[model samples]
Target: MSSPASPTIPIDGPTMDALMALMRLIAAGVTDDDAINDALGGVLGADSDSPQPAGTSPVSSAALGRSPTGETPSVSPFDAVVPLPADVPDVTDTDDGGSVPTEATNTDGQPMGLSPLEFAVLRQNSHVVTGLLKAGASVDYIGGFSCTALCKCCYSFHKNVDLIRILLAAGANPDATTNNDTHSASCLIISVVKNNVEAVKALLEYGADVSYEWKGSNALAMALDFKKLDIAQLFENFEYRKAQKNRWERYQNQRRRDAEDREAKLDALRSRSAAPTGESPTPQPVDGRSTPTGRDETRSPSHAAGGGTGSPRSVRETAQLTENLGAMDWLVPLSDIEWGQQISAGAHGQVFRVTLKSTGDIVALKRFPCHDARSREGFRREVELLTKFRHENIVMFKGAVIDADVSAMLTELCTESLFDRLERTSAPIPWPVRLRWARDIAKGMTYLHTRTPAVVHRDLKSMNVLLDGSGTVKLCDFGIARLREHTFVMTQHIAGSPSWMAPEVLRGDDFGPASDVYSFGVVLWELLMRQVPWPNKNMAQLVGLVGFAGSTLELPDRAPEGCPPQFIDIIRSCFAKPEDRPSFRSLREQLDSLLVDVD
Candidate 1:
């Protein structure tokens, strides 16, 4: 009963004649791209040939714009046809076209028929257009401006369903609108008005805005009014999919906002922690419990770390035993945490993924048995270090609980440790991901070494580094880390793990940041090789081999597939003598240079 918004084409002109000839060539089934380009070049008298490579991406309404291919457009989409009648004064009625202007039009207020692709689409040359698209022709090219190629295809004489699909698959805008102010309607409405069943389906499938209305009447309303049973039937699936999509989008937006708010609060706390008058080092006990004294007067640090008689088992029980306490930047209420499954258990402490009852935010709860002065020192040191360091690659501190019954600290939860990820997955990790992890670890270590006191992460192993949800590396476990006071070099009494420890540390030599570099080298080797360091040796054997044997780790005979070969030298540089070893800053620079073109 009705037709689509059909914009006119100039009736007579050399440009129109050439456009007609191109359309006929495509209609005659000319599928060769080079031949078409040569023919088009001859007609336009162009001096050179331009070829664009087609792009591939997932389609969604969020995938916005006319050309969302992500490739650098070799030339403008309007290159095929342009410079339509600019001298003519367009006539407009006072109501519909009052102030809103429109795009280029000919003397009859129609677009010039100059674009070969648009003309080919109008002629329903599906195969010819597909070939041109694969050969790098832009799908939403706005050259001929019969408003868009999609709008023009809606009125193609026959069942041009395949033609519509070809254009959409090549990244055509399904929701494209005509340029005329009065007829500014979406391609969906144009197809709906023409009762083009297949065109409507194709548009909806390609994520056309279903709720879009033309002149206050939506596609569904128009279909029902016209008694198009087939088109009306499609609305059920459309509405359901749209509802689910909207729900997911809302959830995602809320999560993003919550994360922003939580990060803002944490930043405020971090700023407070860094002030000249920072958190009180003294432990405040709840439930009228006495403050922990030295090991001579109370339980030993080892006894607290292990199972102590009449000790609280979980954070929930610990919170239940506590009295009411006010919340602050440094101190949070013990009752706020909802204890979760235990993530890890170490000789020093137990960590759990706990949720905050007040904000519904999940965080890691590290409960150390700091029942005495000796045990509580680890909690104090870790808390102070966490507050001072707040980099992307470092774990973010939330708050701490220093109850006399149980001492626990809170930090951001991560997905898993690097060691666990590498050991559990049978398939090899992607090079880009592993490369990025190496860079992130280096960045965190560099941040520590560059501080005012030049803190050293004595335990810089794969297990100490963590991977977040996005695969970003976050360094943790600073219990054994040392802050160099008067001098950069100091002797560590707390020995690091044998596998990742430097030879000097094992031999009790004067150590500094170079010791950490040696440990980082072993981690780099793990990332590159995906094999355990000194796998054939035991703890005692590893200590002797790496410490007293004067032996160095060797690169694999062949590099791991997809891994950069330059990292082998980086590892070697890390294993060099104290003076010759590269700084963390230097190591980060080397990895950065190698990953420049890798991704």
Candidate 2:
């Protein structure tokens, strides 16, 4: 057992009475000399001396002249105990007047107690106190006044768990009710108040009462009051821990259930195509090689083998075709069409500035390579989408050319993409011009999303937005654009630009309108900063660093002088979560208001 260090209480007359009272209260049956010496030496800061009483070592003699409890010899008549702070109940009412009593209560009313040193040792000497208890100090003894040692340690000082453990091990009743109705077993309350999970765990393990109502407050209420969520979470059961753990476990299980449902849907989609009735249909090969040959000579029933009404005439004609005829006809198609000057090539298709001879108009012809039938059908669907869409800021598709090996689209020609224009300009686009551009883009995106079929330009990068000579913003490149709820639509090898990809998209989940807002945020960032969004960094690294570390894209230190804060706020708002992001209409309204103010 550790020895108590020393005491700091004054050796004044009133203090001696207080220490004598404290000893009489706590040190019952203290007959052993060493035990007495240890307690006295610790409380009085004793040194060794040779002359001492029986059973008391020479150390007891050294302790004789030292002031008891190391208190000051000088007594002040003015210092007296005032009414306790409103939170701390007044435990002293017996012998003194209604004014709170203390050992050194004086004219001004401030409680006098041990010196600072004594107070500190008393707080930290829990180990020594417990050793004294094993040597036989009454666990029920209330030190000084009515407060027990555990209560004194925790309530007088803050969060003294060392003292709490000693008192508790000495069989301190944590659930003990006081005469004034205040639950005085502060060790249990301290665990809850300080959010000490370990102390709480120990208390529960040792059968501390969880249901004990402590002044309409228990461990759970105290944990909640202190807002110690880690401790509060632990109080779900024995105390509260199990409930918090179960709640989290339930949430995890629900997420798993949702994920399983989504996987089942994806798995079903991967297996076969969705028919008109929402049923998956058996697949038939378009190449017709799965059908048997020699139908005419064998005289086999076509309906029996192929499950179709007698289609032998066409099948027979196909079987008769030789490699020579198939080759001769394939080459004739290449010579008829003229290949034009290539304008641009990106991840999707090669675009050419083509002159249509018959129409006598300049048009852009985008040809997509044919890798599979699914890709061919995707290009066809894109053409269909472009044909139906008509907006001032949208590019018009003239027609599509279906060839044996490749698919192509004819559309209006634009000068260059927005990215190229920005690169050409050295200075930031003028504030007014930037605002107008932002408004135009917002209007276009709004129109696209609000359309009846709801076209989502899955890839909304600066490169996909083209500018005409008149500075009109035309959203082009529908190759990666998706018509809503249409799985047949072409999904690019990668869905979006790296810098502009939303968090959800980067996580390999499908994106919606919110994802578009996220891309808009990057675009706004670019416009404001005049720097490449997600500058010079790989997508994975930036995403990981930003998402995991709560990092963000750096904003420009300075904007053009007189730039409105509202516009800057607009840029920030776009980066907000999907639910918090302002709708395009709201954004337009804000810009309109800002523009009016600027004027």
Candidate 3:
């Protein structure tokens, strides 16, 4: 902690910078003037009358309301601020349920000058927040340090959710954030890190993307670091909204295509008959490629559109991919795809069970938008990696399509994901099949981990593990997977769900094949318990507690109801620290030994 600063410090640098530095020192808990003067030494000149720049506050005055001269204000909190506007009526129960009858004082009762809204928000006075709103104090106004008034509320120790809702409802931007030369934070991030559940709820209700990483701190990272699971559970709402948005956009795109197709077809029929035939010609298969580039021939109805002053679609409906998809030999025509039920959707991608119109082969297709640079790279990686990844336990890459709108990769369809199978099945799984699945997963992981540049399946939850018709485990979802060229790679973003996230990964540290082993342990635990690992749905708390706090997922003290002693040992070993954890090959051999009886 800094020694207490002097009331009058020398103008060591630029006046504003010096003032800012002085104020910062005071804010950081420096209080004794002579000690601060002694600390400053020659820098502490006699001049005490430096003008503070507008929109900046003296040290501790913003919240604690201490005077610039280091003397505590003798007046009450309200005495430091201006009165309400004349046009504004008496404060009523309008903003929240009731008015702030008396403004709540700050931690220390010292007073200083700031607007009513600024004073109330900085001190976390709920009644004052509401009353000021009712008294026409604009929540939209910018305050000290160029921060939005709502941001000040977030900085306070007390999170008054009622006032938060009032501010948001009164048109305060939920996404408004504040940043200085050092730290950056939003209302949601602050609320989450503070473990103020109500404030987080209000922010989320107003459309805050808590998972969104702005600067370095995001609500998800904050939740994990702070151990706030209730806040993390709220992240589900954001994901649901994102999925809904993807579905809605698809619906709109399909509707637009349907309308354009009808118009183009009708125009074509008219043009065909306009050739002055004596009677109506018999219906025939008109060549579909009006504007032909063999691969992009049947792009959309826009290709068939005639040159006219008023064109139906001014621009092309589908955007062409900038990066040509790799491996044209395995290419499938977009026109030949009979899109089936969509199985999953995410921010940048979607998955569907598709049937080939040419070969009538059922395949699982994952779609990525053609636009973003990252998505394009991911599309290319999916092709290059999956084609090389030849293993019975891994999903087989069948073909890919470089559609005008989306880049899609097709893989052999499986019966169902392991997560779904576990949830829907009523009967207890036979030991033979269970052992086989355990062995298959271990084998697949071994194949991935032992490669020249090992592929780390960053997301290794049961949901990404598919069970084929023969009940074989096929590890899937390589969207966030990486090729580990070395022993480990550091990742910038949080990739997998918190339920299976390893401690180092959650802490934003270096990840390796061992990260997958940690997730593998969770799967083994799920298999033994027949329950979802950390299904508590409290990500923030679980991440903080388990990820950084050294809380281990305890293997049952004894063997599970059915099982062998080795099974529990396997799960426990997988959960060990990365360096200490067994390799996938070792794990596979162990699993194979268990499955020897079935074979």
Candidate 4:
């Protein structure tokens, strides 16, 4: 607790550094200025006459009604400033229904000097505002004639506890009055509307007067008007006053219901305990089976059920190996597989259609069949991988369904594959568009390859790249992906699509990142030709074609016009000796330059 006589201290260097670092640490709450000042031997003692710090503009006393000495500026909030134009009314101060009113304007119809940063702070963007504050921005200075930071926060009805904490910790006066001298009692009321009880509690704890009134309206009355009974009761003896009494009725009812629930749970536990222990009440042993009777038999519900309650998921999942073979009929049907049309499948066992559903919403369903080892394992891995990722171009997992026989992963359905989109569309993709797609692909790959444990997408080719309705390319198919250092120890098997497989993968060289780059080269070639690479030749012929050193393939005359020479160069470089290939970062930079030139 702070002593009343201790002077308000300015932020110290260490405190300032912490406050600045707070922009990066969203959960750090607020920096302790007093503690930092105490540790620094009072260097942060309040400077009432201190000039504006470096990188900040001085508060112009003329704009405010007060002098430079921090005195009240004007009778009206707008007094020091020019009166608003006849067109821009003072609606912000109106008492019309409780809607949050927009800010009033000046006579010239221009809003006063509130910058976007100020608006962001007022709107509860604590993360962004903290960044501005750390950069030496001022929040204490009065604006719009005489409105303080607290007044702006109150007017906006911001609910961010972080923003509120930042303002208060930075010395914003909780009791500051508005231009109308309303003293911002209604601001606390607004917090209740936002369900920001913590902010209201913080304000009251900071000495904001709930008893203070304006136009016969006190904070308690404002709370009542907003129907925030819990907040209103906090101001007075909740049991004695009529409004408080009513508030307490609701609160007590809630508490009674909660207590009843707790007691019911306790009763259930007692009943179970009292009834158990006779022969351990284990499940009757199956024919010829020996039961493991005793406490171990009565494990938690999840332990007996296999998958725990609220477990994670993956883009892919596998089934356990022990489920009934007949149960397969109840889950994903083999007939649903549209052999040739569904060109791509997720590593986790999902399939999609190019056609839309009856509701016209395109959809994709990931299949998880129970008791299938591959599906269950894939599901776990997919859930683990997808949830941690968030990027604009990456595919989003919508939801999933878990049932006795099947676990279907849901994701956004893309209508076209990158291969099909390039070949079928009469309009050739512009150089800029191609470059953008290449960059997007690189970024997605970079995120996967550099993630902790590092994911290597063994299948990296055009067919695995899906195009949404907007033509944005998203990489899919993680079937061959493996976490670095996590050896499967299973028999060696061919993992990637044969056509796109690198030479090393066919020879089984423990597929690595460079192999993915090699496949990317084939994909680039396909994109340029707007057709499958080596269409006339079979897979065996293509493999044979790649064996020749220093061999280069030329695009047919029908290839898209105006393709960049640099893009072709990149593809060639990626397919060169693994050690000689440039990194994806270098490729992205080169693509970015090409995009800039074309744009």
Using lDDT, give the best candidate's number: 1
Better of 3 and 4 by lDDT: 3
Report the C-alpha lDDT of model 4 over 69-186, residue by residue, as the tens digit: 3665432211122222223222232222233322333455445433222434433445555544554444554434245555556555454566777877766667665552554444
lDDT values for all models: 0.65, 0.53, 0.61, 0.52
**lDDT for predicted candidate 1 compared with the true structure:** 0.65
Over 4 Å off in model 4, which ranges? 1-350, 353-362, 368-371, 485-493, 536-560
Candidate 1 wrong stretches, greater than 4 Å: 1-328, 485-494
Best by TM-score: 3
Query: Which structure is stronger by lDDT: 2 or 4?
Result: 2
Taking the candidates one at a time, how many backbone clashes does each contain?
0, 24, 6, 27
TM-score of 3: 0.49
Considering summed lDDT, which 10 consecutive residues are worst modelled in model 2?
A: 75-84
Candidate 2 lDDT over 1-599, as tens digits, reads: 01122222333343344335334423243345565455544433321222335654322222221222233322221111111222322323311223232232323443433222122224344444554566444444432323444444444433455666666777766653332135444456666765567666656665666545566656655665688867655554341233233334545666788789989987986675556666655543333233334334323211222234324553332222221122222111222335578988976788988776555667788887645544554565566667777887888767654433335777788868777767656855677766766777788888888888777887887888888778788887766677654221111234567678765554434557777877877776666666667665454443333322223576655556757777778877887766788877777778777767766
Could you tell me which residue pairs clash in candidate 1?
none
Model 3: per-residue Cα lDDT over 1-599, one tens digit each:
01121122122233334323333332233445553443232122311243446654232233332332235443222212322222222223322333431222222532122444554554454554554455344565442323556765665432466667778887787766664212457777767766888888788788775544555556766675577867766664454334334435545666788789999999997886675546654443232323323444223321212323222231232222322332357877577778799987765478899999789999989888756566676677667778899999999999887645446889988858887776667678776677677778989999998888889988898888998888888988787788862222122234677789787665545568898999999888877777777665464455444554445665778875556678889988988888999988998889888777545
lDDT of 1 by residue, 181-232 (tens): 3346778877777787888889989988656667766676667668776776
Measured with C-alpha atoms, the lDDT of residue 72 in candidate 3 is 48
Better of 1 and 3 by lDDT: 1
RMSD, every candidate, angstroms: 26.3, 18.4, 16.6, 26.3
